[model samples]
Target: MKHALNNPYITRNFNPNNWMSDIPIIDSLSLAELVLPGAHNAGVDKKASYTALGISHWAACQNNSFYYQLTHGARALDLRLEYAVGGDGVGTFWFQHNGFRSSRSLESLIMSVIRFLDENPDEFIILDFHQLNPGNQRFDYKEFNRLLLTHLGNRLIPSTHVFLTLGQLKQASHARRVMVAAENHTELDSTYFCEYIEHEWSGIGTASVSELNVHITKVMKFPPGGSLPWSLSATSYNVAEGPVNIREHLDRWFDPALSDWVLNSNIINADFFETSNLVRHCRTANLIKANNH
Candidate 1:
């Protein structure tokens, strides 16, 4: 059976090269008013770790590089960082998912985002550092923050100003600004670290499509007049029978779920983000909101 996500029109209309071109006024909308396409485990690729069960079961969430994800209209990134130890007793930062190391280092991922922002100055991104995993070694939060500031430089949007609308953000600065949310790092300056953003739900661990849909709809309910920006995750975390084929799960649920909840969602994060019309859908939702106002 063919999946809705396989439609040729989706590919043609939402091509990465010009995805943002359609939404010229996107920067002017409030963050909550815009429905941003997000990537879950945004850094995970073919290089992620797996159990003896093989890569099929523990396959990575994303197929393309970070550069590709950004160019394709993924504005929000779910990042997990860890301290990696080498044989020389030296530790470096790495991107990890469930303790599995990604092929790309943390430094490389940050550089990719920096490069993207350098080229596309009008586009802004929400970088959610959702987790910091320390594997067998003690992790230094301060050091990690230092590394982030060193690479990101002046591109970061001051934390105090992140709650504003896209237009307000653009008006505030000429350089592109990225909203950085370092989870559990409340001690950092408010100008760079925002602790109020909420992740409504994550990881629907089911293989049954019907059951998954039920769970997705149930968690998607958000209260009216909420202040913080929240995300509704449309990706599955585990499959009961085999390796996690997130693409298959997305093909089955992405369209239906978006139809039901896109209007209310702040961000719709999924796996294999480039394979579907997620960007178009988000833009449409934003347009609908704009019209209602």
Candidate 2:
């Protein structure tokens, strides 16, 4: 059953490039209180030719590049990385999805974000390193942190001051537009990295939209106020059921109740995000929250 697409928030006037700045009320809200559209496995995309150890179709979550995703209203990015130790490209980091690794280096993706921030200074971005190739190989946290600081520089919003309003946060870092979140690592400097954003995975790989909705509703029950930011994984994984099919299922379930879904979750992350209405819904939810408060 498909839901009605009469959402008032789904508008043509919303500027994805400057979505946050476009909505003046958004600047006054705290980061924790805002609804952000995020890309799951954000770095794993098919825009460029990629070399994968596993099936690319099953692993690739996005079709656009990092810059495209951000310019299209995605504020949060869920990244998975693996460091190459014994290859020709030793010491360089690569974006990965399970066993599938992109031909693109982690630096390339970071540069993409940096470019977006440069173009849209008022826009805030969240970069969550959800996985760092733990247990499979010896990862270098120290070097990794160094790499981040080098590229990100003063652009990173420090962990000490992440609860401030969007305008306040930009001012705190002297107009910085990005925040980096990694797992609890002692080696990671708290001055640069904030607490890693947690996630509630639905853990289902079914074609049934009803099955997916059960998990989405359960996740919506989570209380909003918290020190650490979190995300709801709004995706279903079925190798046989490709992203096109998954996109249809998501649209059917989320379109009618888009506002409700956005209001309940901090980060509404999904695969094939470009094909979904999450960004528009998030923008509308932010406006709704601004008016209520």
Q: Which pairs clash inside model 2?
A: none
lDDT string for model 2 (120-168, tens) is: 8888888989999842457889889988888886788878778888878
Model 2 CA lDDT for position 1: 24
**After TM-score superposition, what is the CA distance of residue 188 in candidate 1 from its true location, in Å?**
3.1
CA shift at 42, candidate 1, in angstroms? Answer: 1.2
- Model 1 lDDT per residue over 1-293, tens place: 12243333434545454444455655556666677889888867654444334553464777777888898888888887788678898778777777776666777878888788777777778888788789667776777788778878588887777778777787888774688787766445566877745676534454344655676767756433354567776766555432244555454444433354666677777777777767766665565555555
Best by lDDT: 2
Q: Show where candidate 2 strays beyond 4 Å.
A: 1-12, 52-54, 134-137, 205-208, 241-245, 248-259
lDDT of the candidates, in the order given: 0.67, 0.76
Best by TM-score: 2
Candidate 1, run of 10 with poorest lDDT = 1-10
Which RMSD values do the candidates have, in order? 4.8, 3.5
lDDT of 1 at 66: 83
**Clash count, one per candidate:** 2, 0
